[model samples]
Target: MQARQLTLDVTLPDGSDFDAFHAGANGLALDSLRALARGEGERQLYLYGEPGSGKTHLLQAACHEASLWGRRAAYLPAFLLRQGGAHALEGLDQLDLVCLDGISALVGCVETETGLFNLINASRCRDTRLVLADTHAPRALSAALPDLGSRLVWGPVFQLQPLDDAGKRAVLVERARRRGFDLPGEVGEFLLRTCARDLATLMVQLERLEQASLRDQRRVTLPFARAVLGEGG
Candidate 1:
């Protein structure tokens, strides 16, 4: 399909783009999502990993890239999608790319399974690319519908790896730079040692530090961060 944008109601979380992601050892997963965003590789992809492994970030990042490429895309979590019943999936194939996160939430729901099964079939007749992510691998997801389980594995499956200590430090520094400040190595180390290490939590802590530093007109020094973030730092 030709690259073209369409105005849609879906909203991605702020800073949820490819550049904000720290690849660490997930280069293959990241590259696959990039290709999918460009409409150039496998039309279906499955990503699974533990909490804080960046599955949701990568899914949103793919949508961000797809939009920048002028392709129509949507991101929907299966929990919310299930709440809307099977009809929620209607006409998803009309979009260039569709990202479904938290798919394991639909495991026991017959209606959602039926909807997704049909959507998968419809996607085959259109140019729609589907990216599904969850904490459990497809084989591990005891899908009530056998056919639906098989369909989930119809494309490449990648297990996203969590970032190491060095990677997390890199993420904090890079994100700080993007926000127009410097995150000193000592400050980063202090945050890592004190705050939640998960990227999501770390990003939130970074936001807090950024706002505090801007308000106080102070740099992000270790002492300043400790003061801003309190004893947690």
Candidate 2:
């Protein structure tokens, strides 16, 4: 796999990309997703993990990289599917890469299943790559369609694990850098202790800090973090 540069932002919303994601102990998942983006590995990839394990981020990263590499790519999250109708899957199967997040959300929805099953079949015909991310493993998911359950494991599966504290710090710092600022280790530690400790919450903290810093023309120092975040800090 190519070396990852953690501060480089992709064109995707919220700067989602391989470069901005902290793989931590989930390096295998990182490598596999990068391979998927490059169309160099298994045609289908299944990723399952706990809520803050960065599943959606990786899926978005895959789509971002795929699009950058000139491959047609789409990321289907639950709300989008609910809004667009799973029939939208029909229009996406022709893309070079498709990532379906929150596959667990389709548990009792037969129409969604029908659309996705057909999407799977059509994608296979066109050699379109597929990546699926959910909180449960394929067999563990209480899917309404047995064939869909069977098909999910036809390729490699990776269980993405949550990052440790060190990993979280690195990720937050990198995220800050991508937003055009530096995050000191002490400032990051303060945020970790003063705000929500989860990576997702920490990320939200970083976003808020970035906006505050830009508006105030202040650097991301310990005092700035304290002043901007106030009670939260």
Candidate 3:
């Protein structure tokens, strides 16, 4: 399926790449994904982690990197295609890389499950790399399609670890720099303490702060960031 035919915004978001990802202890997983982006990989990879562990981030990042090298890459989130059914999986194997996010959401959809299995088989046939992510381990996910559920672990499954204090701060600083704002270590720490610690929420807050800083011609100091983010800081 060509991306242009869908209303869904599957394009890689800004600030999603290896440079923006805080790999933390998941450096090996990051390296593996980079290899897949270049069409030099183990053919299939499954990574599962808790919510907000950057699984989706890494998937989109992989797609972005693959596209940079002139390979056709697609980012498909199961939730967004719930109503579209198996049609979303069509023609995806023609791409060099396919990153499927939120695979757990497809457990109940028989058609989608079969479509995903076909996608996996097609990837193997075409030597295209497939990266799939979910919130549960391969065994934890219950699906009507036994073959699909049991085969999720056919490839390596990496459990992504959460970022530590320093890593979180680095992520914040890097994101701020991308938005043309300076985020001092102390201020980054402050935001971490006072706001939602999830990188996804932090990214939303960062966008708000960027707009606020530009409007007021102010630096992203502790007080300014706090004001922009309000009590969340």
Best by TM-score: 1
TM, every model: 0.93, 0.89, 0.92
Question: Residue 170's C-alpha lDDT in candidate 2?
Answer: 91
Question: Distance from true position, residue 35, model 3, in Å?
Answer: 0.3
The lDDT of each candidate is 0.86, 0.80, 0.81
Query: Per the 3 Å backbone cut-off, how many clashing residue pairs does candidate 1 have?
Result: 0
| Candidate 3 lDDT by residue in tens digits, 1-233 | 35444323665678788788888999999999998888886778999898889899899889888878988787888676575667777887877888888887667778878987888888888887889898888888777886886567767899999888788888888888887778877677777888788877777777787888889988878788777777756
Order the candidates by lDDT, highest first. Answer: 1, 3, 2
Superposed model 2: Cα runs more than 4 Å off:
1-11, 231-233
- Poorest 10 consecutive residues by lDDT, candidate 3: 1-10
Q: How far is each candidate from the true structure, as Cα RMSD in Å? A: 3.0, 5.8, 1.9
lDDT of 1 by residue, 94-187 (tens): 8899898898766787887888898888887797999999999999988788699889988999999899999999998999998899999998
